[model samples]
Target: MYKLICIDLDGTLLDTRQRVSTKNREAIRKALDQGIEVAIVSGRPNCFTIRIMNQISGRMGHITFNGAYYRIANKTRQFPIPKEAVMKVAKLAQKYHVRTYFKNKNLSLCTKSDPGILDYDQFKSQTPLKDQMDMLYNVDVVDVLSNQDINILKIFAWDENLENVRKMREELKEIEGINLYLYDENFEMSSEDTSKGKAIQNVCADLGIQLDEVVCIGDNYNDLSMFEVAGLSVAMENAPRKIKEMVDKVTLTNDESGVAYAIENFVLKENE
Candidate 1:
């Protein structure tokens, strides 16, 4: 009876190596033919999400930037973070000497830190960051920082210290209207209302379906909120113990076509 399906990309839908399995693709096509709405919700940007969608045969919308932007069909809608919140986060990041990345309506900005901080060639292959000044460029990049006019969505800090990352998350919790999460060793900050769960709700409203008429599958901490709202929640076999406990069922590992298994065994069978 599920009318909508929300899927997470990196750890739930895509295999460990980050490719959608043939079995999963076929299963998804089968679901679409049956009138179920499927959406790819992820922390990645639209540029990267589009590449993944191209591999599938059908068209689907995407909830990206951890829910800061929603892309459907050919149009995208952006939700702006309050200017005061952005300024507060920026000041905190600077005080901690943490390198930060900013995303506006049309651009992503970051500092040129130690080459060791990132796999330059790999990053360049995925995103177009050339010709952009590093955050550490000559003058204080802080001067260029204006939360007022920019539709700041989320800000991320890349650091290798797990302890510091934890501390940063705790500190961000003090921010009045923002939500913070720790991914690996990075810290992600977004508006209190912007999350995968909220994005899914928005999509369901558009389709005139109830929240309980949806299924969500994912394998990370950020996905917990979505699982809470889904009627049928699934976790990948490779998911962390905490994530596995939050869902009603655990499917095959992503490496073993888990997404396809769930779709074929549950969603499609229901239609038949």
Candidate 2:
């Protein structure tokens, strides 16, 4: 029997509307009742993930920044990118005119003013939690160099033009000491060799649970690592065809309560 489930947020748990469905919440609660641990592992930061956790009733582990940082109960650990690497990426992002968002231990920051970039407040309001969420309020409009002394957790770089974003990713690949999660029009940068697979391994070791006792579900390239470590890996139906092909099983789409479906069929039924 699986002792734990690691879930991805964006395209697996949350639907296209970016809200957790009632069915998914009920399914998670059911798993908790069965003494199974559920975790929210995502490429998003703590502030955003925490709010989503609040919506679901029960204890849940958090693995964020694609696994660079994690908090289980009161114990927390962070693996920050090297300062020099952060500076290099920041400079390159500026040169490429790519919109960049930075996250430190405490909060997030937005620098590199560009006409193409949306107004901070407007951008914040558009996210899932809207104004209720503390979207980018930490060090608003600060210079990247001024915050060099701070420990940087994650960096998100993107561009309106897909070509520009793709090109930026290519140049970013040449830089050492960093890991990149490539997407269609954006990518996430973190300390070298960071991945959800490693983070889940650590969490399992802490909980005395073996990797074979965990089940992971996600819909993106970032989730691939978790799939590698998990005993049973599931991909959402809405996930890209390539992603689905890699997983052990494919569940319904997020709009169809894919998370709940996976839990009910794969997790709950198997336990029964």
Candidate 3:
């Protein structure tokens, strides 16, 4: 019997509109009611992850910042990049002229090409006005290197040019204290010891659950670590071919409520 379910947010649980479908939400609620623990594992910052979870249930667990931070209600765990490494990354990002977002457990900050245009504000506008206000209070545009109390747990950098992304990622790989994850035109950095797999192990340990009793569902390369550690791994139909090939099962697409389908057919059905 599975004791925990780790779901990815962007392309697994949330649809194209970035909202969890009614079916997905209902499935999650039913799973919770059935005594199954569900946790969101994503590369997003804590505030955004917490906001999304609040939409489904006020009480939920999350492994946020790509696993630099883990929290479930009052319990929490953090793996922060060393201050020296964070400064090195900030300097490198500035040198590369790539837009970057840096986040810790409580606050998030971003770099802007023009002081007049706040990239974070534009991103925040996608949420409700009330939530924007709440997020805004914790988000800021800043000269990242100068922030004495930055305490950054994760760094996300992007540029339109793939070459720039590739070169920067190569340099970042040389850094001793951080783990680098490269996507198409963006890259992420966190503590070397942090990953969704390790975060889930930590959460399971805290809750007296075992790794073999966990199930994970996701649709991207970042979710690979979770797959490696989970007892049952599921990929969305919309996921890349390699991702689908890696998982034990491939469910419907995010638009079709794939998470709900997987839980209903694989989890709930088996439990019944």
TM-score each candidate.
Answer: 0.84, 0.83, 0.85
How displaced is residue 231 in candidate 3, in Å?
Answer: 1.0
lDDT of 1 by residue, 1-272 (tens): 88877889997889878889999888888788787877788987666666676678446677888888886644566676777777777666666666667664344555325444422233334443521222232213354566235567877777555665566666777787777776667877777779988877777776678988898988878898889889889998999998898799888998999988888886777667
| Cα lDDT of model 3 by residue, 1-272, tens digit | 88789999999999999989999999999999998988899987755776778788866688988888887745788999888888777677666666676766645566544243323444454454433422122233345346566577888777666776677677787788989877777878899989999998888888988888898999998899999999899999999999999989999999999999999998998788
Local distance difference test scores for all models: 0.73, 0.80, 0.80
Q: Residue-wise lDDT of candidate 2 within 1-272, one digit each (tens)?
A: 88999999999999999999999999999998998989999977766677788789638778988888888755678889887777777776666667777776454555444453423334343334422323352233335455557788888876676776777888888888888778788888899857899999888888889998899999988899999999999999989999999999999999999999999999999888
Order by lDDT, highest first: 2, 3, 1
Position 265, candidate 3: lDDT: 94
Best-to-worst ranking by TM-score: 3, 1, 2
Is 1 or 2 the stronger prediction by lDDT? 2
State the number of backbone clashes in model 2.
Answer: 0
What's the lDDT for candidate 1?
0.73
Task: State each candidate's clash count.
Answer: 1, 0, 0
